[model samples]
Target: MDPGQGKKAVLNRSCRTNTSFLSFLCVYTIMKWALLSVWDKTGIVDLAQALIQHNFSIMSSGGTGTALAGAGIPFTEVSRYTGFPEMMDGRVKTLHPKVHGGLLGRRQIDDAIMAKYGINRIGLLVVNLYPFERMSRESLPLEKLIEYIDVGGPAMIRAAAKNFKDVAVVVDPSDYPEVVKTLSSNVGFSHEQRLIFAKKAFARTAAYDAAISNHLSNLDNTFPPILTLQFTNGRMLRYGENPHQQAAVYGTTGIAGAEPLQGKQMSYNNYLDVNAGTALLAEFEEPTAVIVKHNNPCGVSVGTDILEAYLSARDVDPVSAYGSVVSLNREVDKKLAEAIDSTFVEVVAAPSFTRDAVEAMRKKENMRVLILPERNTSDEVRTIDGGVLVQRTPAYQENWQVITDRDPTTDEMSALRIAWKVCKHTKSNTIIFADQKRTLGIGAGQMSRVDSAKIAIEKACAPLAGSAVASDAFLPFPDTLEVAAKAGATALVQPGGSIRDDEVIKAANRLNVAMVFTGVRYFRH
Candidate 1:
């Protein structure tokens, strides 16, 4: 055969037949074509073989074609099938009409157009996006990173996804086996399956674009012209904060470290409490433990050992610690596990759990044991009506000025620092009382600072005498100082920027309390 005739023959063999066929039988007897172009070649070979076994032809481009060829699987290149050579450094390979028409052409609505342009309906499309996330993480040149931004991939995916009623779009290799199994059963994909795949495909593209937009926004030193926030739904919780509400957990960069090792399904409240407890515990370098309930830390402490830390923290407010979320900065050992097992905690989060610890935790079937990877210090976001509030995470303070005439003793300073760290994570209008690196009491989310101080004093399980009290914000009046002094609080740490600072200082001096001004307020609402 002549060269031109040979190329036409190959095209006809791979795509649609030029011969006329009755319209009724076209849907069943027409050759099925699967377009495969993916950056992730995880299960492509097996998928291709399965497709070939099901009498479907494979059409791929660039790296996908190379992968199929190397796997000894025959595949028609998109450039060859389209009769258009790839241009612009292989950017224009799959952008041609023939490639898209095969994916988007409708069997019933676009039959005339298909016959006019020799367009073959694509039955399946397997496409995964480029490594934009990985490339953006690397310290690469701008031009280099931009090169990895996929254009044709997203276009093809969207085209196929839009025609999902007649086309199946596969973006995850994990779904390849199911797709193959369906095809093997001679049933192919049902409409529902196609819709599911289409939804995932659209989400994949949306996340990819969001990553690009966020990267550019960071470089421009301004929010993107349109802010695009992307998140992957990590899991479906049992319920939202309340049982009547529906909720799911999502991760911004991926929930790398927050994997549950053993337990029942995590509820929305469990997730919130665990996050709060772990984030607070992450601020400490020593063996620390934090107990959180209703998104507020009830107790926090640092000790020579994990068991001691957990015990000291739990002792602060044993009643509040019941059914709370506990987080440890270090791994959970046998002793710590046994101690935790004694309590009715909803969740326990730590860097790791020893075998003995896991065994002990397993005994508590209702308790959730989470093996946190590493603490993520990303931006904090809260959704409001019709908008979102984004802000940098509060940094841990290491130094504070002692504004009082008398400096805190070394022991008092240690307690003050620990209380300060815990106070930063507490809700606004918060007061924390600590002694010897152990929390004596914590009052959070009160309407008034004075009330918070009173509540802290009332909630103290241990004596407040000689304890250091840390306030989340400046005290507007001397009432809070007087309350703390009456409760035997000897040392105090606060932002100290209120208009009545002079009065507050006078009250502190008269009460014989050593107070320090941090100059920075930590108000968490």
Candidate 2:
């Protein structure tokens, strides 16, 4: 045989013998990759080290790369891997096809495509967007806030999340430990775990976009053509208004005030009742106590002493006050705690609690104790079928116009003012009867104003003589006025914008009831 022929034969034989080995190497070699590009560096070092221990090639960009290098954890720069430097002031770092292809590659379905493009599979993705919400709240310029809006971060997150069947995407640092545990378990992330992460990833991006949209809209108009609201789930309540309905509480800003100190979890009704009590208590600067039941103020009072205020408020209608949420504007002491303990209250909230009060509260293990911060005023949002109504919080009864011939006495005026403030928080067609700055009877959520008046009188059970009455809105007809007069209400306060304002005033004058028009309507529903 010729030498050249012999060499060719030998080479062909060698290739045939190694064919199976090459196929096995291509199909079975375990290659794991983790891409970490995060604005938050929390738990990144430990995660990177764990990935390195599992033989994962860690790829990072910008600050994340710097952090890994400082921590002595080996990582490959994303720019280096993609062979493209970050451009556009570091905005174009990870937008390349190489990065996305690695994240989106399907190991079983798209292996040929990935192999053709020299795309490596990325098994893990850890990314968090820029703090748009935090920066928007700061006094930064609009241009600065716009710059903080993330572009590439959300893109990578969505891409990874789209391929969640094969790729594990983590946006919250709190999930780092679970991710590390799964990777170390040798079985890797299950499909269910990946799906959960993907759901959270989508929600994170949605909330981010909503915040940006709302901030931009606020600059142009208070009532935008299309309203967008973003809320973070604050708590999952034990139940909704009813036990059978599923419920969770979401807040636009967060659960700022109303921090629960002890006791059972809050229910949806409990939250509504607490909000009603707090809103009513906010209207008074003095030591005030408000007892709210079923989203209505059943009792309210203001006094020099906090204990006295609570006792007086509770005494108005102890039957309706049972299982109510009680809120106070002052610190709760041992005496007030003992008094509250006497009742079967659902929740007790105050600005502060003395040591003795906290100790006394421990006796009622099922009663919820909450320490509330000073209330912050924010816009009110109500959801309808497919839309929401946003408006400024109902303004206090600042401008009053006395329509009656007889002006109110000093004590009557004070009581009328308190009743008006409480009426703003009550439901529509509401009537609140009060005297000496204490609520005597409250009838709310009735269909007719006359019924509300009658209910308030019946709830009072005693003669409403000399008590002041507050109507949440205009008296649509004179029947309410007649009912109030017959109930022996000596003074009345209302928004007074009905078509029958003349008739209502005539009835008030005929009954010798001092009526005042606030001009601003507070129709809460």
lDDT agreement with native, every candidate: 0.85, 0.85
Cα error of candidate 1 at position 309, Å: 1.1
Among all windows of 10 consecutive residues in model 1, the one with the lowest summed lDDT is 1-10
Model 1 Cα shift for residue 479 (angstroms): 2.4
Question: TM-score: which candidate is best?
Answer: 1
Off by over 4 Å in 1: 1-29, 252-259, 394-399
User: What's each prediction's clash count?
Assistant: 1, 0
User: What are the root-mean-square deviations of the candidates from the true structure over C-alphas?
Assistant: 3.2, 6.3
Compute the lDDT of residue 280 as modeled in candidate 2: 79
